[model samples]
Target: MGSLWSQFSTPNPMFTEDDVAPQDSKVFRITGGYSGIGFELAKMLYRKKGRVYIAGRSDQKGQQGIKDIQHSASAEAFKPKEAKLHVLWNNVGVCQPPVGSASKQVIELQLATNCLGPFLFIRYQLLDHAH
Candidate 1:
């Protein structure tokens, strides 16, 4: 009952973009950032001077998102390979894929997108950045 009531309650956010410190040297990677909430977050980070990378399955959409973010923030692009990631947002997800749909590795499409993909990305990032 409390959970249902909270859903309708207009509560103020405890933290917002205004609370974030400048991210002039931070690096961020957001999956599924070509659209929706991820896109907005990328924009916010970019506006705060963070180096943002938007990743998606569709290269075209990702490029468009980058362009839009750059236009909005009037920021220049930096080479992502030169910096280690300060944050990785595993925001990519899929819902209710058709039955029997499989990823390239033969796992269910939903599982591949929501679980395995993030897991693998985290692992790779950790290993790559390990000194």
Candidate 2:
């Protein structure tokens, strides 16, 4: 196992405006982006004029988060032209399993959620949109 102490003490990687720069024409889909780190990243990208899609398991939560993010993003004298939507539904669904005391079902769910579902979405929907 890695040193837990070292993990906590390690400095965050430094960045400048150049490093955090965004492209106006890129599409962003941030999984779990309705809160925490994902929210912050979405705000930054959206503020730079990138279209952001928030992906998560809960429809109610995701819509709420998207509104909050876009509202916050548009605060700097620029208004958003449209509410972002229409790309969140997927052919497959992923489940977030509880940590510790894992069951076979939970294990399978986490694997699908954390891995397989994203792969399928990217391979199908995203690629189709890219071209």
Candidate 3:
């Protein structure tokens, strides 16, 4: 619990951008990787040669994040193949519309987006990336 709280704090003591280096041939899929901490982490991965996949619901925001990473990565010396950004369109909404206000389809979509998406991403994506 304490550790979890620290993650929300400023200058979170989790993973730092400097902790990992260019992976070159590796692919990374960050579930909420299009903004905030995810965006910053993606930048770090980009610098380290990791092929980053900014997985999020907002296509526009995710593309913008990719552009930001590309712009920063361009300034650094990197190989051609490592320059492209891959985006996985995974919707991850926190909640559905209040109670009976939403249709069954909407409720299901919300549940899938918020819960199933992250779970599948973590289970399958991480397993796939395992060496």
Using lDDT, give the best candidate's number: 1
Regions of model 1 farther than 4 Å from truth: 1-9, 96-101, 122-131
lDDT of 3 by residue, 23-122 (tens): 7767566767778777887788778877777777689998888888888885343343433335443434556465555334554665666777677776
Each model's total of backbone clashes: 0, 0, 3
Clashing residue pairs in candidate 2 (N, C-alpha, C atoms within 3 angstroms): none
Can you write out model 2's per-residue Cα lDDT over 1-131, one digit (the tens) per residue?
35687697875657743476654656556777777777777777778777777767689988888788768766333234433333343323335545553435554666666567688667875666666
**Arrange candidates by lDDT, highest first: which order?**
1, 3, 2
Best-performing candidate as measured by TM-score: 1
Alpha carbon deviation, residue 26, candidate 1 (Å) = 0.6
Model 3 TM-score is: 0.53
Candidate 1 residue lDDT tens string, 31-124: 9988999999999999999888887779999889988888899666857574477888988888898999999999999999999999887788
Which candidate order results from sorting by TM-score in descending order?
Answer: 1, 2, 3
- Pairs in steric clash, model 1: none
